[model samples]
Target: MKKPVAAVDPLRLLVAILLLLPLLALMGFGMLWLWQSGYLLYWLIAMVVCGVLGYGLQQLLVRQERQLLMNAATEPNPEWPPSADAVWQQVEALSATCNPEDWPLEDGRWIWDLGQKALETVAHCYHPEVDKPLYELTVPHTLLIIERASRELRRDIAEKIPFSNRLTVGDLFRIQRWKVKAEKAFNIYRAGSILINPVNALLSEAWRHLRERSFDQARNELHRWFLRAYVCKVGYYAIDLYSGRLALGDENYAESVTPESKADLEQTEQTAEATNEPLRILVLGRSNSGKSSLINALFRELKTVTDVLAGTTQALEPFVLSREGFTQALIFDSPGCDSPFFDSKQMLITAGSADLILWVSPANRPDRQAERQFLDALRSYQAARMDRRSAPLLVTVSFVDRLRPANEWHPPYDLTDTTNIKSANITAAVRAIAADLAVPAEQVIPVCLLEGKIYNVVDTLWSAILNHQDEALRIRLMRCLDAKKRAEDWVLLRRQMAGAGRFLRDLPEMLGKRSEH
Candidate 1:
């Protein structure tokens, strides 16, 4: 409980009365003497007037102080969202003190002192504790709960509170109480008692601000107090979400895939020892749609046979593609989806073993009905063998040069500005084909591949491929899908965002339930 400013010193009061007795006796003797001399009548009238005026002023001050105190005591706390602005400001002020120029050495250390005062202030109000000395409460006889709260907050936030954050309702409610305690601390600190401390003069200066109605000076101190307790209550969860654990590209996908990942790696090694490669990606599309060319481009060599025919490659052709910084991957150039020879079972066998699937289509083709059917069948087939997670599909619209005026060749196309004929054609084709295939617009990429020619192949295609490869690896680790499984980036992000949204939405309810418990 919050102790009083100081214990009552009865000995001092007794000494004061004893000392006043002689002065009182002398004044009585002088007054009696003056009355007998008949000269006290005028003085008595003046004394009575002065005494009545003093009593009236004292009563007025008392009434006003009591009203303000009652108003402050009865003020209901605001809800989380409504009070968020002040709480946010409070958090920022505390964060700013982390690097104070005037008191660099005392930056976060002062927070502990403030937190102690806050806890004691709250205890005094709600707990059945008798008034005691502040020195006793703050120093040698400090409560365990206040000490632990300060220590935990100091450790969790690294002693530097966060400035701006999406602090949940739970955090705000907890902080609201700390804020309450802090304000009470200020009220007590203003009493000018013998609660000796290093900050006594500073508290007096802060309390003096109320004369001018400048609450910031005192409220700022209270804000610092609230921040420490806020950190103790909600800081850990804040740091976790702020770190972006759910986002992709995090090494190990923000999780340690330890013992079980090793087992999966061993099994993968035994099964694919012949290739000894970590990943195998398949480039599949309609015949003559640049599937073979894309593979050869990835290899930077004419390793796969290419022909301008509807069914040039009637079988699967595998080649190795390696990059300086990336793991070596086996790239397979599969037959066109329209190739009459390959049935549904054959399609899965060709695609089932691959770690990733890259679907290529021509930007020049206006109708993708055939390609759409093939993709749908492939998705179902891949899903049946793999988990519901579709294999990471990176779709590339190759032959962008073949999009416009047949003769027009362009190295770069600004898809957004549709005035340029080639760019316009490319934009329209991508939009139409993407809409027709029911795939996200971002997945539909435009590229042109020719030996010794570079266009969108590097700028667009390779970037998307490398990105999808990482997700594919993460999924492999997740499902132990050595045989074949794919995870889409959109799917991963959507699920992550959904989970986050649910958490934020349910936070108030969770706090209510916990409070009941």
Candidate 2:
């Protein structure tokens, strides 16, 4: 049978001190008044008498009250044994079980188990009918359990891996920090709050740690924890967002594929060059901006058709195209760059490693998001190059054939006839879009990559590539990419510096508040 829990007394020994404070203050004040009136002996006598009387009365009252309570109390029960010995024994056992040699793996497992138990305990203890006790007792207990678990895990990791070894130490610290964060998140979750951010952060860090190590044990541990963490995060976020518990605002929540998202990571062990390296062409635009159709059209002209959608091209697809001089270059079709889903950081990282960037846009519907992303990516590419020169920014205006009536669609236009009205109209339209994109008017070329009888569409693209194959063009492209990258870096650096300045300025005030507490 469970023993009845006693209510904690609000009035403790400290309450007596609080109650006597006013009387003591008044007595002191009276003595001071007497002394000022030239009654020093009287003041001293009164103070001594009151101090002795007050102390005696407080002690006597407290003793009598305790005696009365004790007389009314029931007989002591032996069924409920004291818990101190059992708790100490458990602590000793735990200490003995946890060894430094077993380190991160053993400690990590222990923490994981403790966290699960704590969660279960709290869930069982929580009662809407007994809100105060449930919150005050159960919530704190849960936090302590999580904290203890986290501390144990951190200590174990620290002991197992010395700080000097970059790989081991870095991975261990990352995992430990994540465990701490997970504890904080679990606390928040118990209060009916979402824990997606921390869970995501934890899993992300764990993924990095696993990727850094080749050891089977570490890798297995990482995979297990990462999956669990990711499931928790995804489920929490999905529930909260769908149920209107979390705000989505205007931010895009498109799933991003990180290095850790790969299922067969062993494939990554191979050199990047061994794979079919495609000339990654980045198509940028808003949704429904004909970016998909443009790729379709290009593939159609090349006598091929492939999947088209943002992130549809899971991996870069390389297509070999032969030019007039029997020259060939690999062309790559990439995922469309759309607003919200367009990760500039990842895109720039990819662009830095690409040989060329084919910036594609549709003639009918132009998107500003696509234009801006392209420029940003190009800038990043230039910055990453050894020599800062702009890569050949080949701008292609797709679906030009759509401008004419379907039945009257022509294959090619007369370049020599400057007075040709139809040719002039197409040229003007292409130039206008180019101007909007901030690309040079001369660099923009209109090509109907989809037209069955497309005149010189392939030739035009090939010619542009051939013309810029020289060392000078390479140098120029590199410079342009570098300049753009530098500009972005400057902007980011300035913002970061400003933020640091603000933090420094406010630190003193924060510290002052903390000290007072």
Candidate 3:
């Protein structure tokens, strides 16, 4: 749609030279008059002093700008690997040692070379022993990084650079060619001046040298600025790739979805089913550990069946729990661990989907072999996944009232006060439970889930759940991302298969047409 810029305009060049010639002659005559009058030396000295002062000011401003650019270059992302700091430092070192004179000023090929070198530097930090770690990148992931970097660069140029959108590559090259011609013309004029007046020429040259030195310094600084920006951009995406934040087939999906339409995609996730699946909170315990009672207490109602007998919950029962000040979640009450018919496989599946676990332990029970073994196995299963975040575990020591001094039925027992025997025994039981389950003492909350006596449910237990809400949300996000990626893969696979079948069906007809032709 746009016209290309001409390489040269002889008429325009002639007009410019003609315009400059009169001024040049007037300046030459004026200098000759000053030399004869013996004022040229004083004028030249003043010019030299002004040029030095101007150059000094320019240097100061440039140093401040360079400091800001370098600071941004060295700043590391929080998710970057431990060795990223050293890699960034290497980038800074490379930038410092770079010489603008060695680089082709007009050609942009060096920009690509700089990016490639930065990629290698980042890759080496990830695998120092390997000769080339370029194989670490998958095609889709590599394309993702390129797309993200290019999009960001384009955005910056459009938003920050003045009139950059109007300039084409050819236009820039044309400007560069004209600049070279101007420099040559200026040098020729300087040589001619020297031949005409050697003393004046010598003084003028001294003043001109200061200006030329400033130009060279500015050029070199600009060169370093470009190098740092390009290298840091590459490193930023490199960190994203190495940290697993840059996912394959994710960018395309994200790009297609607008902010207002994001809910459509969110609805497609497994966690976003009918009623927008609430955060799953799996309740685990031994027989008669008051697991059902704890769930009922949390809901402030008789949400699940609670009995003193073992195997009260014969299967996993899920109830959507929505509290005023708590995260909306699905509380699954499972069969007691001591039940003979307990399904470990089903439990594992439910546990895998859980964002949080509420392990209820009875204060009177000391033998916890069954609970401990199941917990260890569950933890191992979670660790093997590696992709998903581990669900936070909260131990609720129920039946605290039945611990010590059974006659003493107290409310608001302060465990900090060691003199209170009941409180001390309850605290001891909590610590014991924490130790047995390999959980932190702070994570273990003591509660009395008796029919009439409900303690710590609102003040302590709910607060712990709220505190772990962020972690649970992270786990949920990872789970949903996996589900989304799986769906995307299947859809793509089906599309490919359909295309292959269509091509085979039309193959014979196309071959017949080709033979007739």
Q: Write the per-residue lDDT of candidate 3 for residues 1-517, one digit (tens) a residue.
A: 8998887677876776676666667777888898899998888878778877887987886677667545544356543334455766776665565566666657678867776777777778777888988677777766776677667666655654457799998998999889899897787577666765676678778778877787777667766666566666777777666654455654333223222223433443423333443577999999899999898998889978777777878977777677786656667788988897689877887788778999999999999999999999898987776445578899999888987799898689989989999999998998899999998999999998988899989889999999998888666655554555666678878998999999999999999999999
Q: What tens digits encode model 1's per-residue C-alpha lDDT throughout 82-155? A: 22233334433444453223332225565555444443333333233557423333231243334444455546
The stretch of ten residues in a row with the least summed lDDT in candidate 2 is 252-261
Q: Scored by CA lDDT, what does every candidate get? A: 0.57, 0.47, 0.75
Task: Report the error of model 2 at residue 474, Å.
Answer: 4.7
Question: Which residue pairs collide, candidate 1?
Answer: 2-124, 391-486
Instruction: Score every model by TM-score.
Output: 0.42, 0.34, 0.64
- Give candidate 1's TM-score: 0.42
Arranged by lDDT, best first:
3, 1, 2
Candidate 3's displacement at residue 332, Å, is 1.8
Local lDDT at 347 for model 2: 65
lDDT of 2 by residue, 1-517 (tens): 9987655335643464465456545555655676679886764566557655655665565456445433432221111112222322333333334333443443456445533433333322233355353244334334444444344435433443336235574686798789887765444333221132333334334444443342444444333433333223222222222222232122222121222112212243322322222233444444444444455554444423433444554444445443355322344455556645556667666555444566777777644656765686666566554222344566777667666443456557764456765566677767788778878876777776543545444567557656655532333233233334444457767988999999999999999999999
Q: Which stretches of candidate 3 lie over 4 Å from their true place?
A: 1-145, 152-277, 323-328, 342-349, 403-429, 508-517
Pick by TM-score: 2 or 3, better one: 3
The candidate 3 region of ten consecutive residues with least summed lDDT is 252-261
Which of the two candidates, 1 or 3, achieves a greater lDDT against the reference?
3
